[model samples]
Target: MDDVSSDKHPDRGGTRRILLAGPRSFCAGVERAIEIVERALQAHGAPVYVRKQIVHNISVVEDLAARGAVFVEELDEVPDGATVVFSAHGVSPAVREEAARRGLDVLDGTCPLVSKVHAKARRFADRGDTVVFVGHAGHEEVEGTLGEAPESMVLVETAEDVRRLTPEDAERVSYLTQTTLAVDETTEVLGALRERFPLLHEPPSEDICYATTNRQLALDAVVAESDLVLVVGSANSSNSVRLVELSQRQGTPAKLIDRAAEIRTEWLEGVRTVGLTAGASAPPALVDEVVAALGELGPVEVEERRITDETMHFELPSALRGTAGSRTSGGQS
Candidate 1:
């Protein structure tokens, strides 16, 4: 199941307790990206080549691989004219052009929010503005967005990094951010950029996706009451990593795990309440497995704390909409 519930079941009894974040796991953008791959598989058949991990979650990639989705590092590895998917992190215009040149059938799984950041960077370059893109260096999304206007854009990962920057045009400056960044940390970096360039122009709208903000906010509350926090997600997942950092910033102990087996027994020592949440790309099954593992240690009670309601949904790529009916197996549905 894509969604998870923290509600305590009547059949279960335990002194240990689990507090689940309501808005945790499988956000709309991740949902849409996963759906794109599944629908493409249904419409085009197996052996669909994905240029990268469809999303950051290993479970998702492994699951898709089990269903005949071949993961590749580059376009040349894919047979010419075969179908390929771009990851949800988005890609550079160069990569898109290259795919066209290769005569490959391409399905972009880039999140719409990420596409918006790319568009904003292009616009800033067109206006002759030096764009300061605040994000981790070498991340897929950062690489993609930077590729949009590399000559006009400078990448900064921290407040100090921003201070070291010497853009060609300080007076004509604009800023954009990666969508999956930790909200509070990104805000602080943005604050520093503002201090440096008081005339800094902001993106057309908030670049951080609503799901990232909501999950961080919900995790804030989860941290307050938890003896220890465990974020269920792959280490490579950006949003999942942020949730762990957000908890640590709150002075709470937190660990990032891909599954239940990674949960250390020593961490559970003297802990009565554990807060559990998964990244946007993480599946609810991982959360369930963690809860079951906790129960094995002792009696357990499950409780859900929903900070905000997320009713947001992204539309499928127009090319796959006709095959939407066959998309019954994976994604958030």
Candidate 2:
């Protein structure tokens, strides 16, 4: 971890500054979730069983791992009565009940936005509408959304998935999406849904949040102007991975780095204009360290390319009943 130290800047004097990414770091949901984990680690100590990547970034998981958090994919992997976190992507009702049945101290990190989609999917299915969920199959978000009405919701990853799906009740069909999905991808899926089911019912509120859309737009705007873009996130982070793909899709070569140490000097060869952005679960400190590393390589000039402002906040779950505080340092949604 010392590899990402500020000393990597190589300046004789002090740290070099760069234009930081706006709307970078922890959203409200991420903050609360991280807080939940930290509090559990502090209060409980050692081997807190997190059912999935708490928020997707590998660095975050590693950091927590060092602090004695144990990540598991299923409840069976955890011993009975162990403390567990459900992940920011949310989980099915069955998972919730299972966690309870095992007597686990459960702290759900499900994003409110995702929970909304789950609710909508369940409601749409209850209305007897053949629900078409637009998202990558097997994704945790999609799984949670599908769980809302698994009996009725049909999974579709691409436009072709929509075209091929033969809904049981086409006339009364409805659609929802995974929160962290790419805007263009969802648009393509939505377009196909429209063509296949002309009377398809759209959700009252768009499942994708403002943060995801804005980040992608910002990257698209910067990619054309930059020589190479460095995405500040982990490979496991879906949002971070998408940022790399988005830059590539925009014709800009990009790389995903969990820390400044991961940045290969070779990728910097002959590249002057470097764009840097972080995934929802990535910490701002890691982004700063990357810029510091770049300053060592050359005279760096940082610029912020922002598509919009983000001021949204989700309240802490009332299960604590507001008696406790919920806040985390930094990362994405």
Error of 2 at 50 (Å): 1.2
- Give the residue spans of candidate 2 off by over 4 A: 1-21, 319-333
Task: Give the range where candidate 2 is weakest over 10 consecutive residues by summed lDDT.
Answer: 1-10
**All models: lDDT?**
0.86, 0.77
| Worst-scoring 10-residue span by lDDT in model 1 | 1-10
Give per-residue CA lDDT, model 2, range 1-333, as digits (tens).
112233433332332324344566556667667777877776677888898888877777888888899999999999998888888899998899888898988878888888888888888888899988877767888787787778898888888777788877779998888887888877888998898899989999888776677678777766765557888887766777888898888777889888899989888664556778888778777887887788887666666766677778776555543444434454222
- Give me the runs in candidate 1 sitting further than 4 Å from their true place: 1-14, 324-333
Question: Any residue pairs clashing in model 2, and if so which?
Answer: 25-331, 26-331, 280-332, 281-332
Task: Compose the digit string of candidate 1's lDDT tens values, residues 5-67.
Answer: 233212233387789987888988888888888988889999899998989998889988998
Which one is best on lDDT? 1
